[model samples]
Target: MAETKGLGYELIWKFDMPTTINHIMIMEDIQYGELIRKYKVEGKVNGEWRILTEGESVEHKRIQKFDKVEVRGIR
Candidate 1:
């Protein structure tokens, strides 16, 4: 994916059934320099969107671990 240049972007994944999420990983193509300076990982919990983790920056990769949550979708 390409940078949005301040417009920002969002990507989502949906499962056929609720799946327990323990952690997430995000990566940037460092060959072009890290463009992602901030990001958030959220999960759909109990029909509501809840922030699972957030960060200030991500270079080549970032991994976030959190208490397992069951959800049907994530973004």
Candidate 2:
């Protein structure tokens, strides 16, 4: 996996090959206090986009799990 840091509001990752994923973890820098309130996770499965999961009130970190699915990309 690779990560690029920037001041953007979205992140998109495309794998070199299809991969099976079940969970994702997100973290926030809260030195100034919690700022994120809601978020969503989408996966590209079978060449289509699907909503995998969503949640609210993310203080420092969040871990979201869903049914295993083979995906080519995630955002």
Winning model by lDDT: 2
Instruction: Residues 10-63, candidate 1: write the lDDT tens digits.
Output: 887767778898999998888977789888888888888899999978888899
For candidate 2, lDDT tens digit of each residue in 1-75? 444333388788878889999999999999999888888888989899999999987788888889999988888
CA-lDDT, candidates in order: 0.82, 0.85
TM-score of 1: 0.86
**Each prediction's RMSD to truth:** 5.0, 2.1
Residue ranges of candidate 1 with Cα displaced over 4 Å = 1-8
List ranges where model 2 is wrong by over 4 Å: 1-7
> lDDT of model 1 at residue 65?
95
List TM-score per model, in order: 0.86, 0.86
lDDT, candidate 2, equals 0.85
